[model samples]
Target chain A: MECMTENGGYAAGCRENRRDRATMQSVIPDAIEVDDIAKQFGEVRALDGVSFGVARGTVLGLLGPNGAGKTTAVRILTTTMRPDRGRASVLGLDVDHDAQRVRESIGLAGQYAAVDESLTGSENLWMMGRLTHLSQSASRSRSKELLVRFGLDDAGDRQVKTYSGGMRRRLDLAAALVHRPSVLFLDEPTTGLDPRSRRGLWDVIGELVADGTTLLLTTQYLEEADRLADRIVVIDQGQVIAEGTSAQLKARIGTTIIEAVFADPASAEGARTLLAPLGELTDADDGRALSLQVNTGPRSIMDAVGALERAAIEPLTLAVREPTLDDVFLRLTGQRVE
Target chain B: MVPARARVRRLTLGWTVRDSLTVTKRNLLTLTRNPELVVFATIQPVLFVLMFRYVFGGAIQVPGEDYVNFLMPGIWAQAVVFGAVSTAVGLAEDLQSGLIERFRSLPMAPSAVLVGRTNADLVRDVFVIALMCVVGFLVGFRNQTDALAFLAALLLMLAFGYSMAWVFAVFGLRAPNAETAQAAAFPVMAVLVFASSAFVPTETMPGWLQVFADHQPVTAVVDAVRALVLGGPTASYVVTAVAWIVGIVVVFGTLAVVRYRRVT
Candidate 1:
């Protein structure tokens, strides 16, 4: 919220940055387009002119830290909340005017398990089916099938309150898919799940995407997004910071990394000055070791070692590796991707 | 073949009914599972009716064989009013459980939810009225108005019960939590109990209280039910009671719908 108070002179200086590209047209695409979406909670702008799109049959993961605008975007797309400024559409239908149609085309598994605890696992799905306007016989049949597919057939008769968290989450997912929606929305589905349950859900999502479900998943875990999403759109403070495939984003910074590990202190200072002209040197731990970013392959590592050897500086360990998405995020945002 | 649109409409209605019955069944199950709640829900009306009938029946005379007969209609209306709280409390529980948000995500009709809920409450309220009627009869009260009149009295009480539902539904929706709804129900119910002719004749009250008891909707409802079921009063009270039913229904019903949309 303090960002709003520091804007009088800073806004003018920001306008002078002329390097910002005119990327506004990208917000007007057809499948899922949001333009100038802004929302204010008192002095806090939850979404500050947020804009983005996701094409049909493509999985776009909305990635951000906690309290980011990812959930707000999903809420707007799911027709739960409307933006204060811009508009949003899902599958060519406006979220506000065509909310029913939008809801019909999308299935959402929200952050919490939304199932009724008193109802049996099968009854929960049957009740959802009834809400979807399915025939009684058809609803029963479909509910039974989803139960079997989700490996919940054995516990179909038990009340949901008796089930474990993983079982409940699985049943929740099955309930979301009962309508056979074309697009599925999952907002931090794995936020509270253990590792094994999360992996099981990952498999379920992988299968869903493989069989042609256009999934828009919002998650705080970069690894989950990387494993499940074909493309990720990183959002922070209600704006899209970056959007691309995993490999495409990693390529933003150079691919190769010359990581030098030191056994003890007092040796990395000599290595830093020796390799400073060849590449940017980052001290691994103050003066313990030296790491560098490079555009070339293992040749940079060899040159650094030759330079350090000529300078009579001894290094304990050296390695050449490719940078991960975490490194790419740090390079762009100047903070760890927490 | 029938058109797809027709199928969807038919299915939506089917779903609404199914959900409503499911909710009613759940409430009934709560009573059966914890039989103590059954006694607790009926205890207040039973206590109030007894206080008015046997405790005060001989002192304040109506032109009926037993003063208990005159008290039955007033008791019925009050019991039905108490029963409307179930709807509000049930809705508040659903809100607390996040079940309403689950329903919101589905392709369900917007109005179907409240409609189903209000309808289910109607059934539960009527059932509670029947139990009160049985209790009244066991205590030596007889209905001189016959079976047809009894049915008419029940329907009027149910209609009045149906109208009072709006007041609580609003509280339930705006209530930040389920406990808020439960806490707010008591004083409101007490106000209606005090203002109505549930205990004493409106003519015998003090001047200002008489005017209030006369103009109050609950008094009109109680007087009408008394005339129909016990049949000592003139036909005018029945006319006034139906008017009260319609008037409260129109105003509070609209308010309930508006508040529902606002809170949701």
Candidate 2:
């Protein structure tokens, strides 16, 4: 949670960085850069000229729904797959030309948990350590260290097939860190975890960021991106539709949502027409609820209630909230992120 | 001090060996955790031995030898070749589970996973073949030749099995899942194993059937091993068997490596 909270300050710092962005780009350097990278699989264009960069020691959330080319971008950046056009580099090394060296400095946890189920948790990590060229003793020690750090000490000797889904994810992340990689790519790291497990993973990832590990995290969950990422690059259908900080993305919608729910469709419809002049009506599901975006904030809330009252419409419930990332996503893509 | 290029070359070579062995140990450890994997691999052929030796023994005739004597080499060859199917199944399972993707992303040698898998499965094949040999003895089969010749036969069967491991590696990479790998491998292997001279000599067959039975790789290996262990001319069959083994290893080994590199 230290890094999670610190991220707000970090993002503010990044905003200040905007004034000197050009000079800072020359000095600090980007840990990962994708320049118009494109990839096609048979009839499907998985990535269509996508471009972005992650500054050193910052988290970049590649936010998108399924099949949006986030994993494709990650695969190209991690040196596991090649793009059909353009280029990418990691830590100043070309991903395609210096793939071996790139691999030595980076770690990746793919969408699927990739640890061997037949091997013990300790054995999986130890084997990864050995493959990364650690000595036998070093491998054993690192395995033990990571097992404890990830709260897998008691299950270290058990086969991974016996582990729960959340435990397997922790072990997978542990395996990726065994080599102390400088840059890490996690594709949908908490895609299938429960809320509690996802939050726990977020904390661990937050700690990693606090230690200055540059991370490229792809996720479908907007709250995950909002909570952890210093910057977000929202992609849809293999294209970057929006890129900004969480607050900035939310600000793009430029309004607060006023939702009024009535007991019946006729009353809801009545309220909609009465409240039309107050703001632009957006989503009113099944005609029983009405949602509108008003730019004046709290004053608009008073206006909406007064308008409804004058029309003799009794809303079963009414609430006002700032636009969430979900609202931004829906506004940008014309479809919900889910 | 070494030149920069040579130093990097030495490091790459060192890591290749180290990484491959690490993966090999990982696969072997799975066997220790689940001994039934080996037991089931051995038990299937043992059942074949019993079924063939007792039920078919009284019906079939070998010109100058007991049916068990001729059958033992065939059974050993069958067991070793069939053992190779696990290579395909194991690899397909790894691919399906995304473990292969993890390995590809690591700073290891490109061929390390394949090398580790085939080598470990070869070691398993050796164990299963040796156990089949003991089963052969218990069921009244004996080697007519000296100990050196017997050792040569065992080694030959192992090499043939190792080659088949590469062939199955291709099937594994092409298959989408473990079940598909097993399904594709077993039927093709069943045809190759049962249609060859492993079960009966081609001399008793029709001309067209004998042509296939006498010329296939499985038949060449079985005939070579049978000759080395059961007292017959050894040079030609051994050479032919070795040639087929080398050819298969070259072609399918290359194919498997290429498929592995392109695997998504």
Candidate 3:
């Protein structure tokens, strides 16, 4: 779609421009780097020495439960908030010492869609473009180009207040892309969106990554991280407890799970005892259901059902499923991702 | 293709100014689109003018002048002060809505948001003042001075309003929400505008209260604007008014900017 520059330029041209500047100094392997960043609000430590790095032209999904400092870290890396005791750099420029340069090289779509409700979609984009120092014609053309790219061209002249939630989100994303920043930060971008809208945004993000843009996205949706992230960092409370690819995280949780739901609490206990030989049985807090970590794949489910049938245990439902990112989060943090 | 040189150029003062103006344009555009805001802002001043001219004008006598003439300047000064409240509410709204965060994340000059907000509200205050002037003229409020003097009076009132906008911008940033920002602005407005020579002569008040009324910034602004419009000694009052305006802008403007930087 030639969406890199909003003016029909390859994304590499912008990368080359940044490379020329980076080479003048020292080359930066990562598009963004955070080291021991900390922030506190009076008595509460919002971010406790969080550190991460995003390799150039890749997506780093920051997975965290609420209050886990994902937004705080994003704010620090975007040069909007200063860390209490550590450092961050974006595109090889120090966020604190060279905040202006860092701001020029990055775009941020905050947890909330931050477009002005009073202005038209085009006006909002035009304002962002101008603020980034694009010339008047450039700003106008870029706004139009972004509107079309984001599928907002039909509603570009409408006030933002009239936009649906998904439309506002797309406009907000378009606003961030107006200046063609090399590194983009989306803080829970798909949050509050329906599944269809979320899928649409995911496609747009995938395209941006394919075009060589570096993205640091924070999301509470484990499935989203698994689907779109090249690497995922899971944070709990105010610290990162686990970091790896989606597969690596899932692998840590084992291969398969045999989930059985019985008609009554008594049958669930009987099913659990009958399926004890299959694999490790995870403690099911719900009396009417039980889950066992099966070492074997689908065959283990058959074994479990056969054993239950032999024991004359009538299970309401039984299935075999792979360990999802949700199970990984629950295992690592002792808390559910959602 | 986008030019690399253009992308990497250092931000100039001209660019900052242009960016600020763009933000200002957005603010004004929003104001125009929201008819209720304009109507509400302008209606208050008109009501004040009508109420004072009809209800209080008959009982209050200002030596040799008509009450409408005496009340016009006061109404204008009061209207400008009240108009500044929108700055606080507007800024707080932007903050609560996350628009401020978006601007903060952008590469524009840090002062652009504050400058743009204050400048746009000043333009609104100008409109409100002109509307009040028309209302005043209809009610037999005549200007004894020349057109230049009247223009100076209007400019001084706008300058005072602009400074008040900065003062409220600080409150807006401190406020947790827009409603709180609006509430926080009221006490300051009342203490400054109502306690002054806006509606009544300072001489008629108690001696202890009169000291504050006569010396406060609003009194100076109102007296200066009144003298300029009604043919009285204006030199000292004009100096005091300008001093108050500049002083407020310096103290509150610096504080607002500092607060803005620390708000993350």
Clashing pairs in 1: none
Better of 2 and 3 by lDDT: 2
Give lDDT: candidate 2, residue B124. Answer: 94
lDDT tens readout by residue for model 1, B187-206: 88877867768766777788
- Give the distance in Å from residue B181's predicted Cα in candidate 3 to where it truly belongs: 0.5
Better of 1 and 3 by lDDT: 3
Poorly placed runs, candidate 3 (over 4 Å): A1-28, A259-273, A281-291, A296-319, B1-6
- Complex DockQ, candidate 3: 0.61
Q: What TM-score does chain A of each model score against the native chain A?
A: 0.79, 0.85, 0.82
Residue B165 of candidate 2: its Cα lDDT?
94
TM per prediction = 0.81, 0.91, 0.90
Q: What ranking emerges by lDDT with the best candidate at the front?
A: 2, 3, 1
Stretches of candidate 2 above 4 Å error?
A1-26, A259-275, A281-291, A296-320, B1-11
Report the lDDT of model 3 for residue A115: 94
Best by TM-score: 2
lDDT values for all models? 0.74, 0.87, 0.86
TM-score, prediction 2? 0.91
Question: What lDDT does candidate 1 reach at residue B177?
Answer: 78
